[model samples]
Target: MKTIYYLFGLVVMAVLTLVSCESKPSLQKYFVEKSQSNEFMAFDLGTDIIKAAGSDNLSADQEKALKAVRKLNILIFKSDSTDTNVVHYKEETTKVKSILKNGDYEELMRVGSGKEGASINMLGENDDIDEFVVFLRKDGVFGLIRVLGDEMTPTDVLTIMQLVEKSGVDMAQLQPALNQINGNKG
Candidate 1:
């Protein structure tokens, strides 16, 4: 009787293990895991970073947009096109592509070929997008950016990002990572 019970318990454990491992993965989960790896660069920026650009000069609409956004998550796998780097870039970028394509995200734009490309996707229905995702791949670099918010319209995001172009946003937290990725370019 004891042996039979032990065998039954073992079978149950095996099934549970397989089931847990078989669950579908998500882009958010990928970010959480890879952000810790030394091979990748991660930045979790809150609304303050955007406000830093020029909060005092912001229009009413811009302020509303800024408040709607909760945070931005950026993950980058930078490479210089070595054989090992090529392999890592392909693997990580492919995983991200799979997650975005297969998940609930709706593609807003996609440009480029197998070797290089950029894609924009959003989650949520028309005029009420909650998250906007952009992934870009160049010859020696790949990056993912997630703009998470609550009930943000497309226009709102555009308004806030325009502030970044004016060049007042702080890059202190991103300087090191930016240095690593762009250092060899020029």
Candidate 2:
């Protein structure tokens, strides 16, 4: 009887191991760590964020992007330790419009309202700490991606946006689900 019980336990353990391994998503393959102005941050489909090196600040787009991600892995920058001042403002200029001139991703209609989506711009004029006001889809679906740096550099923001675009997420499918969550009548 003991032999039979031991055999059963071994089989259960093996099955459990296989089940756990299979639960990992295929998107995990895309994660990659890259060097940034802040320190080192990873980017990819599975990676939702890369924290500001030892600082509380995150670029506007980074914060918004993380919210939409179902799974996230963040690498904190370890080198830079300086603190900068964060300024908050609402402005109507596409200051970094040129960064997204390629226009690979098209904008979707807002789920509930037709109003233009809001955007965040964080500036550190005094070399304090950079911050950004982030834009998010109020319907909880999608929004414009924004990332702030010492200045809104063309490459940094574009890099983050491209990573998000390539994540194989079917935004069209996600929109309806998001609208349902928000209880959108429209």
| 127: Cα error in model 2, Å | 10
> What C-alpha RMSD separates each model from the true structure?
5.8, 21.2
Candidate 2 lDDT, 1-186, residue by residue in tens? 999999999999999989888633211221231224222233322332433343245555665444433332322222122332111011111222222222322232222333235434433342332333343332222233323334434344444566556444445534543444454524
Q: Which pairs in model 1 have colliding backbones?
A: none
Instruction: Point to the candidate with the largest TM-score.
Output: 1
TM values, all candidates: 0.79, 0.25
Candidate no. 2 TM-score: 0.25
**lDDT for position 73 in model 1:** 93
Q: Write the per-residue lDDT of candidate 1 for residues 1-186, one digit (tens) a residue.
A: 999999999999999999888668898899999989977888888877753444587778888888889999999888766899888888888899899989999999999988789999999986888899999888778889999999899898888778776646677766766876885432
lDDT of each: 0.85, 0.36
Off by over 4 Å in 1: 1-22, 51-54, 183-186
Counted clashes in each candidate structure? 0, 9
